[model samples]
Target: MQTPEQVAAAFDLLADQHDAMRWDLALSEFDASVLASLEGIATANVASSALFLAGGSGREALSFVMHGWKCDLVELSRRMLELAECRLHKFDLRIVESEAARYLADTTEKYDFISMVGELVGYVQEPRSILRAAALRLRPDGLIAVTWVDSSSLAATRQTEEQGVVALVERDDLEIRAWTCETMQKYVDAARLTVVLRSGRMAESPRRFWILRKEM
Candidate 1:
């Protein structure tokens, strides 16, 4: 796993190309799905505040802000946050440049919704600790949404051995960690969050998304 500094540097280097690469990978579809899931939950539960972890370029944050939701976006990459600032100028959003674990540890404000998307959960070395921190900062009836790449899948297994770490745009090292669905579930369960909604398309890749709620 890459340290926070290394990960931030990698993302900073890729900041300019992030949106184009995402579009090329058709990840915007998955992002839309996540936004839809969040929207549904927010409508049903009347969510007002949200905390978005590792929010790259703040696309999801833009959606939340547009919908009249107060958002706090935490990203490790300063360049990414710069882009986000440009995109989310007139919204109720707070942009923080810090690692997710550190930010969660330092914040005492509870949120009605929390999200760690773009497979950011897989990049964490101690995912369980992060989840626990998120759980602690969540309201009793709040929701947490996360996504992970299934490392046990054939595609990920092949990539793990071949391109574990590579240079994106020949600028910085991009480290990819192998995190299976079971591994993610174990962490979520350990954090005492119950899975309420799960969806993913495994035909081409092992990327999956899940929405969890605090156990009552």
Candidate 2:
């Protein structure tokens, strides 16, 4: 298995190589389900007419929204936020480069559509807290599209032995938890949210996508 440090280093390498890193390759290597969700997001347009992208990197998603849904992207990385700004200069995109956790907690801003791709759920220190808080801010009938790695997979377990740019290392150094589908669904129900879509996909880590709507 590759070391966790090696996984991080690989992303840094991608950042150096492509102006925008290709996570689709990583997802194809882990779980196939990721592609389906991406395709879905690309096609679906929210009724609230407002979409929010969490942990957005570069601007692939925001580009979609700018051209399709007319929404904003909020992220945690300063580097990513800036790069997105540069890429999305022509569009009316909003980028908030603050800790996603803090933003979720402090945000009074309500969104009709919330998208969190690329295991954004696991990236936060408290995935449940962030999800629940975000759920509350939604207008009833608002949608939360969240994806995370299923802990059963080799990549999720950090047991992957694959070579050539796959994340093999367990990021134990990052104080975050890996979640399975059931665990995430538990959090969704606990947040008093309703599940509208439930399915798994094959991506970099056997990713799972959930489409949730806040219950009135």
Candidate 3:
């Protein structure tokens, strides 16, 4: 299992090529899905604040900042955060270089909108705990847009399972934990979050996208 720092190192190695991939929609389904979901959240309620966890290269934060939302982006990789700063320097974005879990633990401020997309959850050691922590930082009516990896979807060389949690090893430096939709929903329930929007329930895809609201 790779620690958060190890994962950050792996991402740092990919930083040079990451921004290019983000700009190309055809190659970036994750960005497209997240942006489309953001539009939905924007239409229903005009969110004034947003927090992006594991936000890479400022593409998502860029959209929120452009619309005048006070944006704070927390990224683990130094290289990635540097690139994000270059893109977001014009805006008053609070870009921080810290692991998402630690930031959530230390920050007392709450947000109206929070996004934990990319491999934020999968790369973490305690996925459920992180989700619960994010929920605690959300305002009552706030929305959380996130994505999770499906355990069965990866073509990993070796895999391990324990109590429904699966660790997928694709390469020496590339390892991610995954969970089934049912298992992930269980985590959401435990966190007191309700899923308002789900991309799909099918197991065909490796990643699952969801928009959650703190349960009243």
Candidate 4:
């Protein structure tokens, strides 16, 4: 299991070319649909608040910010936040320098929407704890969008069972955890969240994108 420091260091090294590399841009594009569907849903004339956990360079969070959602982006890498600050300096959103799980656990502020995309769950050692903390910080009717490494993939399943970590076929040096569908359901149930949406073309990708909400 990769420690937070190790994960942060890995991301810090990628901060400069992160945006240009266009890593996970497809997932970001898919995330915008949720933002579009939720537009103008804030109560009492207040803008809907959205939290971006492990949002790198604020790229995916841009959709939420541009949609007029009040946004907070939490990232562990100093270099990433520096670039995020530069790109989002004119915006009103808060860019926090903290681990996602710690920020979720510590924040008193609740959000209408929380995004843990960019494979944040898969990168972490304790995804269940992260999910639980994020769920606790959500307002009623709030939603969380996240991604996971699907153990349905043969490579992920075999590697995860044998080596304890699955290496990304696209970036072999980057190792991550994978979750089976049943395990993911158990985690979500433990967090008291219901799956609102689960999407991915498993034939094309080993990652699954999910949207979760508290039982209302």
Model 1 stretches with alpha carbons more than 4 Å out:
20-28, 155-172
Instruction: Provide the lDDT at 81 for model 1.
Output: 89
Question: What is the C-alpha lDDT profile of model 4 across 150-181, one tens digit per residue?
Answer: 77665642354433445454343356778677
Error of 1 at 108 (Å): 0.8
| Candidate 2 deviant stretches above 4 angstroms | 1-19, 23-53, 58-60, 67-70, 155-176
* Structure candidate 1, residue pairs in collision: none
Task: Give the per-residue lDDT digits (tens) of candidate 2, residues 1-216.
Answer: 323344344434444233434433443443335445544655675423344544445434543554455566766444555566676667666677555566767777787767776566665545667788888778887778777766655443332222211232333333224655666777788888888887765443466777888877
For residue 153, model 3's alpha carbon misses the true position, in angstroms, by 3.6
Q: Give candidate 4 misplaced runs (Cα > 4 Å).
A: 23-46, 156-173
Per-model TM-score on C-alpha atoms:
0.85, 0.71, 0.91, 0.82
Distance (Å) between predicted and true CA of 9, model 2? 11
lDDT of 4: 0.75
Residue 34 miss distance in model 4 (angstroms) = 8.1
Candidate 1 lDDT, 1-216, residue by residue in tens: 468999888888888799555334555566667767866765665548999899888876666787788899999999998888877878889999889999999998899889888877667767678989999999887889888766655343223332332111223376555566666778888999999888877465566889899965
In candidate 4 the C-alpha lDDT for residue 72 amounts to 95
What overall lDDT goes with each candidate model?
Answer: 0.76, 0.58, 0.83, 0.75
TM-score of 2: 0.71
lDDT value, residue 143 of candidate 2: 76
